[model samples]
Target: MVLPGKGYRFHATGLTHDERGYPDMNVKTQDLLVRRLVDKIRLNADKIILVDERWMEDAKVVVISYGITSRVAVHAVELAREKGIQVGSLRLISLWPFPEKRISQLAGKVKSFLVPEINYGQICLEVERCAGGKCATISLPHMGGDVHTPEDILAKIMEAVK
Candidate 1:
């Protein structure tokens, strides 16, 4: 998460607070800060939004994953490839300020996206939104306590190709 620089301070209601400040309660101030942050993210997107894409040129299915699940997705992608499936992998290194443009571009090319996440489905929702109905977004959701097995993701990948 991003944090304000040291010695930075916050002001609210025309009163400056200490270094450890309270939330900015002013709507106008909040809006300005949010807009600035978004602009920064857009201006430096290439540096801020990091992703690792592999074997996408002729892929019918792209597996989108991140964090620990990304590690698992790697093995799954290898397994699918061994079976001669036209599958690819996209590992998200920066979750926030999502790589929407890349996802949207890929959505137009691929038949579907398989999102294997440890949650009930968070990032998968973002993938679905960015895909914009151009392609299917499948969520292989695991409700915590354990990560998805390679076979589980490979199964979904096979289903997606079909």
Candidate 2:
């Protein structure tokens, strides 16, 4: 069940549907929406929100990144590791619900979070919102024409770990 998303680097061709206004939410539509919400949460949440969490145990900082920007984040992570930084990275395979619980838990244990995104901190807003000042939080945001260099992200990781 691969969902359509903006993975522009991979050259995905799926359209992102845009709908607004729930004024027509009558009984049938409302029930269907409710059932879908429950089924996604109660039945298949773990399955839906794919995460790579191997580095959680010892990481001092966690990088939350996904989509096209995730590949760049990997380079940053490797560089940080080379410099002997206990930096971890989490690629958000699902964007919704924002991984609040995991972020909060990591905040309790780690020093901070680094979120690098192609846009001007759109997703970072959600991260800071969920972080709730638990630990240090920062975002490496760009205007979306070019990706962040590993050096750029490394600098932020270095700053955050400090």
Candidate 3:
């Protein structure tokens, strides 16, 4: 089937790479496409800040997240607040480029940022970069595809506060 946003064409048949046990070239193409899609998502998100709030004029901790991951992050922030932690959240819908300026602004007010993501700390690196050394940053990472529990993230938030 033809894919949207890309061109498709027919070419003369070549050797049967997969039939001989060699990896299918299509698989590589698919990987490239996935990578491109991810890049696009990140680029689009560069300017958008999905969530923004400041609990105090000089809060010490801020949380940043994206997509389904963001839901759990919100929960964690709420729980942290209830427990008297001066934590705030900035949920990012876009992830590739990251929200650098917003993070820099947060760094001015907070001492640390708690980054939670489904992957094994990929986005956490970006958070650290955006933090610009104005604050310390750490991650609450989940390697699984599923979302992390609020208690899990809240626990990290608790740690960052200390």
Candidate 4:
């Protein structure tokens, strides 16, 4: 399970605080803890990463989204397919220790990717990283609230295909 973060929420909350919200962890301890947690996830990535993809072998573009945004991504993918665009979909079932290899393999098939998400380009960064300049990657980020409209994603797909 993943808990989406926010600028305000992360700022307002912290585990380092005591009952009265005072510092309970020193800078060194906090840094070490966070570093180790991140290292653990990356070290055991194969056991953690999960992705569910619906892609066409000849697809020129893929629309990838996660969480609620994935719902709209499917709609947009269908709309693009209806328009004769070889579009496909990929849903990020797991957020951390991202499915980098899966995305990289897809980059060999698809010409580009359009990733829409509620947050500001979080997963899109991973896509770009794994893509390794093999193909284009686009981000249709929303600050928060609602998901992307089919038209919005379709428009981006159209742009990517072109």
TM-score of every candidate relative to the true structure: 0.82, 0.74, 0.66, 0.72
Off by over 4 Å in 2: 1-43
Q: Least lDDT summed over 10 consecutive residues: which range in candidate 2?
A: 12-21
- lDDT pick, better of 1 and 3: 1
Residue 25, model 1: Cα distance from true site in angstroms: 6.4
> How do all the candidates rank in terms of TM-score, highest first?
1, 2, 4, 3
lDDT of 2 at 137: 75
Query: Ten consecutive residues with minimal summed lDDT in candidate 4?
Result: 4-13
Choose 2 or 3, whichever is better by lDDT: 2
Off by over 4 Å in 3: 1-58
| lDDT per residue as tens, model 3, 57-133 | 54678888787888888888888888888888887765545567778787877889888888878888888887889
Q: Model 4: per-residue lDDT, tens digit, 113-157?
A: 888988878888889999999999999998876667888888888
Model 1: worst 10 consecutive residues (lDDT sum): 11-20
Please list the C-alpha lDDT of all candidates, in the order they appear. Answer: 0.88, 0.77, 0.75, 0.82
Best-fitting candidate, scored by TM-score: 1
TM-score of 3: 0.66
Question: How do these models rank on lDDT, best leading?
Answer: 1, 4, 2, 3
Model 1, 74-130: lDDT tens digits are 889988998899999999999988999999999999999999999889999999999
Q: After superposition, how far is residue 126 of candidate 1 from its true place, in Å?
A: 0.4
RMSD values, in order shown: 4.8, 9.5, 7.8, 8.7
Error of 1 at 139 (Å): 0.7
